[model samples]
Target chain A: MDFELSEEQRLLKDSVDRLIAKEYRFERRLDFLRRSEGWSRQTWQGFAEMGLLALPFAEEHGGFGSGGVETMLVMEAFGRGLVVEPYLSTVILAGGTIRHSGASGRMAETVERIIAGEHLMALAHNEKGGPRHSLEPQTRAKRSGACWTLTGSKIAVLHGATADELVVSATTDTGSALFLVPAEAEGISVSPQKGYDGVPLAEVTLEGVSVQTEFVLCEPGMGEKVLAHVIAEANAALCAEAVGIMGDVFDTTCEYLLTRTQFGVPIGSFQALQHQAADMLIELELSRSMAILAALSIDSEPPVRERNVSAAKAQIGRSGRLIGQRAIQLHGAIGITEEYKVGHSFKRLTAIDAMFGNADWHIDAIVEAGGLYTA
Target chain B: MDLNFSVEDVAFREEVRTFLASSLPDYLCAKMIKRLHLTKDETVHWQRILNARGWATPSWPVDCGGQSWSPSQRYIFQEEMALAHAPETQPFNVNMIGPILAKFGTDEQKAKFLRSTANLDIWWCQGFSEPGAGSDLASLKTSAVRDGNHYLINGQKIWTTQAQNADWMFALVRTDSSGRKQEGISFLLIDMTTHGITVRPIETIDGGHDANEVFFDDVRVPTANLIGEEGKGWTYAKHLLGNERSGIARIGLSKERLKQLRSLEHELSASGQLDERETVGLKRKLAEVEVQLRALELTQLRVVSADAHGANAGAAASILKIKGTELQQRMTELVLELAGPEGLALAVDDHTDGSGGWQNPAAQFYFTMRKVSIFGGSNEIQKNIIAKTMLGL
Candidate 1:
């Protein structure tokens, strides 16, 4: 029944907050974006040093045995600072797939590399017109004695251009499978995309790319199960991140209302604006509750956890738009600039909503399961 | 009451279409039709061809080499040029500085720069927006100090479009500090090759390099370069903005893009990219923008006709600025929607598979067109202008 963070979880949150204060200042975030990789390697290394990179992995895998709640703590802080590192792709999603997949030799070594910030991986599942964001990926994987070959196109893989490895999902003869393919493997092509929020995104294509048998993270039967769990974890992380963004946007807009003056008085004095600001606050609080729900329910039974995360993601998508736009409308011209914080927050919210699935898509998922309560 | 183009205006439209088909280069036409970027050389080359035919500066005064065309004729000319996929006439030369010189410049200044500007022999860029003075341009700190026969200019200007390729820059510099912030500004022209001047290209959000930040470290300019009276720069700046809003609506460009989007939608739908449900949603959104544009066109025509009757079109100009940009932006957003997630891939030329090349620029144009709402008196400012000037609030 207790909602208070554990002492260790409180320490984790504090560490993330400190790192953000030190590294993710708005100007420094812009600096990272200007770099070739569109993220800060030094900050990623710092995460490795702080043991934040290994937060969600088992201690046996050279990690801290943390779970979704710990990841939530890190993501919320990262969101407030608009951190552009691909932590969601590299750590929460791809790293989770590996940690839960029970790999023995090379795969465990890959997890170690990831914990050390020496390797970055992304899950490539979204296809152009694939069914339901590729829970059952259509990418064809064929085995030939000692090796497997994959062929498909992934439309939007976050940080796809910078990933050293990609956890690609493919369909085999019996069922779907997950393979850890080197990003620079033969017949692999990546075209870089400009993310709406300055996150590195790309269109990745594979044409008969050969993968060794040892690189298989999950066999045919386990692939779809692992992928669904990975996506649910990602959805939970994104919701927490969105809650942080909405809270920041609401706080800044209130500050702006107090400080920004027009017509010889602070604009916050007007009752019309006061009501709008209050509505934004309401949306923010509701989204926060949903994010917390997702974080706490991450390890529950399958249907409960999946339904909760989808509901949280949908709430974020709806609420983020209201809060982001309210911030912009209240701040006027300065809010939409590239240099400003509020506009970038809005962009990130937009990018979050677009990823995995948008609000309507998830709402449809909930309804297709005969609504949230039924699930 | 008559909304149709006159018989002569229709003939002029046909004449413009014929001339564009004959004169517009094939490569440039392809670039314009495909919405691809045109090189600075290609732009200047096209302007020179227009200049050779005495059609480069149609809106200028007849005494200053203008065609003395009616307002309808000019509209037809611009619309026809857009429809034919010709490269746009460089606005800095014709719409901006050329008309200013005709109105207020000294006879010698006109003789020195007018013909050269018209022929694109001297590419011009605006240097009015300083880093500290975007929407509130009167707060600019760029200094122009008189030293005998020369004025030493020193300060920075940002968002200066085409500064790298420009041969000259017309700028607003602070010449005095004793009076109101808006009163002490002076319009001055500085040659781009002047010593102690540096142009740094600023990459915009859309990954375009059309804007720059120019730094002046004690650059010297002859007093002859000053436009109009000293401390009257703000007045000229306002006048320049009025002219700037002339094509801000860019109706013809939007119409062409909408036409292109229609075809793209059909192709994607035929390829099973868009299902019936998605197609219905997209079609409805497209129809909404088309409806808004049609209404804007009527209002624009009313403004044109009202101008013919000597009524001021200031209120309608603000309306056009707001609604026109909204429709343009809405269309780009729909293209991004049609592109779905794949639109984020902007590297169109390199290894495009499973989708048309049109998908790449969907995100590019959506991110890039955001400037239309922010720049040249943001849509918010336009709303305030509408409220204060039109509504008497």
Candidate 2:
């Protein structure tokens, strides 16, 4: 087994690192967050120009054929920079769903547009009520001549307000299905808002929104697999991002400890604080391992892929919580201030931990499947 | 970037499993599966079988009777042994003194000791931690003074594991008194049967006599037993401890434990012992710990693979120790929890033999596992190392 990145992967990682280091400074991030749009479209186009938007699509689709490892590299850099682009919502969650579902015609051209930096999309799968993190949508779909009308509310539609089109999940008479519906389609309204971490989220209401029969991403028999695959991909990217955030928080805390002197010496010289910092580093490394493992497992068979992704999401959640808390405690007041980078890291971590499946929820899922091993 | 083992590694693993299946005695496997204590002879027997295959000391170089296995092959061998219910190669012989002697011993010392050490002809035990020198090992007062061609050893060593069964004890004795505490110390190999030496058993909370208080009253030892130069015992000890931390996770052991736990869960349902809710709760706890183990297992692979590329993330070493020991203890605790009322039975009897895993001393195993975090530099001490060395705290 090998863990070393390939030459191309390393080069890709270096470019992302350099781009983020040069442009996404802390002050620039704050300024971007303060804007009316809450993020930068210019930065989004810049990512497309860098070919990141094209990274995960297949070569047959006029895109660079890449896999989860490449996504891991990019997301990790985004985490380090605290970049607030719509890559996850647009590229992985929405565009990725269409690409992986093997949908041709309009859907395939949409993916082409996404790769060419001409389109933005968001996934509207999660909804309110029922069990937490339930993948089966409460949204309903109605049959119409040469069309389907969707009638349901999709809560927390990540980056949905700005998307050119939305990938919507709904239940039909047979089972669940997904459709690519235009954002400005009749009977669609979005309550636009920003998450606590300052990323865009919207409550998308689909009141009999009409979609042509041709826009069905998947039917009942195949939709579940595609949704699970894309969700795992998103979670893997998020896991990688969490690792990047944890690493930076850990390093920043260490720097603070070495320089933040009190009581006649650096406060870090205290055994209690030192041990906390050590614990943070341990969590960071473990989280990183889980992230890599999750990335590698994205293409495996369904059972293995789902189980590993849940395991990684849970582990990253737990580690992120511990590291974030320790970072705050170690830095004292500065760690929680709005101006400080560490607090922002903690907030992003909090959001990531809550998204898809939190640690405890994922643990419940694993046990529900009769644990990770058998006789 | 990949976790797939190569074709050669898979075959090597198969070879190891085949050897274990053919040669490992059922009686010892039974003891290992249940966490029952094994007699010293049983441990020696297993180690010899492995040694005869040239597999017992795979980490050592080929010249020292070790296999020329790559790191992954060696890892597979170690992993297979654990999965097959085989006992670990005696740490004092294989992991500790043997490597030191191979790395730094004189020609005569290597010729005399290396083979027997691997073959289990010399059952070695460490004599390091004194009553006062648990974590502060530098303060050890055990002394060796020169008497012509020999040195007289004196003072005491506590927590010498399996001392009663040990044929030899490798120790760090203070050879000079006028230097720093960490200095003036020497690594010595002493015959356990020597005169003026006494081994007093220290009964642990598990009710096992696995350790002792070894006292040296002017015990005479040849200067030839000295390893490398004098006053470098601390450096050598560090090397030995570093080796200990490499495979500290023991992922295969934890995996096997989880497998046994799952089977036991099935038995619990078949016996109509646990209610549905209780079964679900138990499974949840088991999955949490299993997930934790998987995380550590991947972390270990990351470290190992990084090492293959000549990038040593030694800082991740302490992560292994802390998480590895915690999972071990958690496993024992889970077993005890499964045992429940049956565990409280006063009779010292097992419901099943080694064939079905009923001889488990669940509470005792739980208590015994407590020593893991306390020993081998202790988790606290490991954190201190990480704090100073890795985190720059």
Candidate 3:
């Protein structure tokens, strides 16, 4: 019935907006991207100081308990700023798995370290040639007397080189399980690279890396459930981020149309471009609604939650492509340039569409999940 | 933010469902469900049923014999009615002119038209679009010059739906040839039986005489029929258009069509007539459209919730109009595609009652739905409004 944000949610949004507006300028982002780590340590600390790293963790685990809507607000602000930090990789993906599967002792301690900004984590669930968003990993975990050995490679390990530890999903005889392996663990290798959007990524290879049995993040056969949960949350965050990017790109294009003129009057006065801009607005608004729906249902039962997340992801992919492509088309030559913010937003949106699952992938998943036939 | 209805709203929905189940005659529901055109008598009977229950004018102010329901209540009523296959209460009277009169009419005008409108005693038709003024309504050349206690109206109105059955017509005519095109217009109510008035049928692509071209040659209309001040017809028309766009989404009607589509798909599969590849393609198309419709429905809820809280919903309403009408058109196309070879039979006589299984009427329905996107302010005009009001272009 009510769609208004709570007062606290509004305050969280304003604070993030203020921080991004102050520090995350386009030129500043470029400088940070060129650095050795490809992001700002100072900004990461600022996020930790702002309690964003702790927002989604339970209070019993040294954090302030928040939900998907809060994460949506922060990610939306991130989208507006085009922030290149590892919040999605380290916080939501890795940290969320730890919290969901890590019931006590050392795993909980690692979460506290994450909250305190003393440790960063990355998730290595995606393997080479694996199906999109498949939880049954090809990576194998072999058990010994008091330790486990992992042998496999993970592709597109987001923030893999920068993280202190990685939560890797590996299959065993019974089912799949998650293990917390140190980034520099013996027999582990990290090959860092830049993604299409210029954020840091790496391909992580495990050559018989050994880990203590206590490093098992969750019980056997629970990896898929935990991974699905975290991925749904990630999808919700990405949906919000896409909305933010589309909003900015749309606004920038509209402004360009008004000020950049060719034939006597502003080009925006042309009916063709005006209608295109209106279409962008429609896509953006619909994406916004879907994002809200996804965020609100993130904590529901598995069927409901997965259905909503897939729906949101599918919509975001389609709308993101539409808005991004139209934005570049409307901006003419400047839209494809590296110097312009609109092009960068387009790149990020494109990357987000490919991430988790693209539109076609989610659509198939939705149909298989019975989302279509459900009333 | 919560999206669930309040307890009272939920109960109201149940009440509406119950009322519709018991009161809406099965024959009328059958006609609507089959996409068959309802005769004027059928439409009036349904309207009177709603009127007798005091649920006819849900959007008007309470003092004007309206139910004074909240936006959510109105939305629920609409959704329930559409799902129940109940006939739409003929928006020309209940939704269009009734609100205009309630908002801007003199006390005398209100007393004369409001009750009759709610009771379906008078069937109203709109006369805004002319030959050259479809999307650009301001360019309409229809003029009404002043005579002794009357206006000598002389012009033509095209695409006036149901004019053949109309008892009265609310029209916009140029009262002065001065200043801006929008500044000289006046809104006038005319009796269909007036002298010099002609309602000639315009056969549509759907093979129905549902709309007409109304010609006025020195049609003497009393000046008392004017709703508001002279030269202010555009403003009043804008108000009515806004109301028109709000309900243009037609989510409920689309839902019913979707239900029928599912049944047809089932029938095809059952009879071994379904092509697997084509069926798969149709399923994907149906799923995509359904997903978009669901999003549109939520977007509508957002607008309704905003309206309930007294937020400006003009831009939101335009978004609904664009998406709603597009989905409606898409649904019709899907239904036609599902009919396969049978959809080519468009003649009314070719259709046997309850025997053709949607194919006989599917093509006709598809042709009729093309008008939805064109009317109620063309989707292109809606985009222009959104650009100006929402995008600040």
Candidate 4:
């Protein structure tokens, strides 16, 4: 019923917004983007100190049990700032998955480290042959005595190069399972990959990597649920991040239009470009709504959760592409260059779009599940 | 800060829902729910039901037969109507001209028009856009020359929707030729029965005569018919436009369409194996549209709520106008896509009850909606408003 955020939520949003606005400037990100690692450790430690890393975990687990909406607020601010931390990987993907699926002692320890900003973790789920969902994971895990050894490659592991722990999705004799292993475990090597957004990704090769029995985050054969939850969170987070980027796109474009004069007047005064800007505004607003709805359904029981997650992902995916493409189109050749921040935001939007489930993928899922109308 | 409805709002919501269920006729509700073309009688019947309950003009002031509910209450009431498939009060009378007259009408003007408009005693139409003055409305060339307590009007208006069915019209006409285009105009209320006034129906691509080209050849009108001062018509026109833009958004209608789309998707999915690309793509797009619609609705609520609280964001009204129309057009596009070949079929004898026959209306509707973004100040004008008024462009 009510759509307004609570005073507390608004305050939280303002705090996050102000923090990112002040400290996480694009110049710093540009500097970091040129480095081999996409982000600086000190900036991440500052995020930890600000409790950004701990917002999504339960209070009892030394974190805030903030739901998806709050997480969206934080991520949106991060995205607007273009903060180069692996918050999406460490906090949202691996850390969020473990926290939601009845955290084990080892998993809880990892969550604690992630929240403290002492360590990072990335979800190593997508195989080279599989799409983002890849529910029936290709990574194989065999029971050798009491311990399990996983052998396979996880492609495009987001922030894989920086993480200390890797949450690997594998299919065993019992079905799908989520295993948490050390990033530097024996027989595990990562080939660093640079995403279009300049974020560090890695194609991780696991050759008989040993994982303790207790490291299984979810019950055997119950990993599909864990994977679903992770996908939902990641998808929702991506939507939120895109909204932030889109906001910047609008802002940057608006400023450019106002300052750039044509026909002896600011182009912003021209109705044609003005109309286009209005449409972009509409798109941005629409994407924000999708992000909010997706975040709202993050904790809901399946099929409903799955549907909403797909809906959000799909909408955001389309919005990201539309806005990114439009931003470039509106900005002209200067936008395609490296100097303009709009280009960078455009790239980031496209990359977030490709992650999780793309718009088409989610739409298909939503249609299959009959989620188009009911939710 | 709390998003939860207050206890009074919850009670008011239930009251509205109950009234809509018990009071609005089933046939009319069915027409709205099924997206069937509603007869004038069906629309009038539901409007009467709402008027009888004194819930007809929630947006009007108490003195104007409005209940003067809080913004949140109005929001809840309007939302329930859409959710329950109850017919809406005709916007031409209730929203467009009524509010304009209430705000700027002379005492004589109010006595002559206000009551009839609220009760639907007189069907009303707008005459603003001329063939030349579309988005540049101030450039309207329709002229009203003063002559001994009356004005002789001569001009042509295009895209006048529902003019053929209307009994009265509120028009923008030039009153002075020497001043700036905006300053010379005036708002005039003209009876449809006046001599020298003609309405020629313009059949839209939708195959319906929803619009008309109205011509005036020296039509005479009493000076008393003018709302506000002669030169102030431009101001009143601007005021009327704000209302027009808001009404055009029609967030409630979008919600209804979205609901229909969801159900249709389910039926389609159940018939057989869905084409993975088509089915999923449609579902996700639906969700995406729903999200935008939701945000627009919330923005609308905030605006209405502020007005109810005696504050206003009138300057940002264009924001809703642009988004609302775009979302509506997008929804129609999706509906067309879902309807597939059936959507493309023209309304023919097969589908109509011999009244209109069977051709699917989706394609026609989609075509009609293409004008939504181009109308109501062209959304381009809206951004200008936002830039100057909201962002200080």
Evaluated on chain B only, what is the TM-score of candidate 2?
0.96
**Recovery fraction of native interface contacts for candidate 3:** 0.55
> Which 10 consecutive positions of candidate 1 chain B have the poorest summed lDDT?
B347-356
Candidate 1 per-residue lDDT over residues B1-393, each given as its tens digit? 233577887888888888988999987877676556777888999999999989999888888988877666776777778877888988889888999998989999999999999999999999989989987889999999999989999999999999999999999999999999999999999999999999999988787899999999999999999999999999987886656334556777777777877777778888999998886666655544553454455555555655555666655666677767888898888888888877776755622132346778778778889998988788766656543442232
Each model's fraction of native contacts: 0.00, 0.79, 0.55, 0.31
User: Which candidate, 1 or 2, has the higher DockQ?
Assistant: 2
lDDT of 4 by residue, A109-144 (tens): 667788888988999988877655678788899888
**Model 4, which residues run further than 4 Å from truth?**
A104-108, A262-265, B1-13, B26-42, B82-86, B203-207, B244-248, B258-319, B326-375, B379-393
| lDDT of model 2 at position A295 | 93
Q: What value does the lDDT take at residue A106 in candidate 4?
A: 55
lDDT of 4 by residue, B1-393 (tens): 233578998999899888887887776665565455565666777787788888877677689887767667766777788888887788779887888888988788888888888888788999999999987888999999999999999989999988988899999999997978899999899999999999999977767777899999999999989988988888876776665333445777788888877777777777853576677676667766765665576567656645655565645478788888888899788878777776665766422232441126667668878888887677767777766652466
Candidate 1 Cα deviation (angstroms), residue B218: 0.6
CA lDDT of each prediction against the hidden true structure? 0.81, 0.87, 0.87, 0.79
Q: Write the per-residue lDDT of candidate 2 for residues B306-376, one digit (tens) a residue.
A: 66666767667788989888999998888888988777653265323343334247877888899999998
Tell me the tens digit of each residue's lDDT in model 3 across B1-77: 88788899999999999999999999888878888888888889999999999888878888998886888888889
DockQ of each: 0.01, 0.78, 0.63, 0.28
Tell me how far candidate 4 lies from the true structure as C-alpha RMSD in angstroms: 3.6
Chain B of candidate 3 achieves a TM-score of 0.96
Supply candidate 4's per-residue lDDT for B346. 71
CAPRI-style docking class of model 2 based on DockQ: medium
- What lDDT score is found at residue A277 in candidate 3? 91
- Candidate 1 lDDT, A108-170, residue by residue in tens: 688899999999988888887757675677789999998999999887788899899999989
Candidates in order, TM-scores: namely 0.52, 0.97, 0.98, 0.89
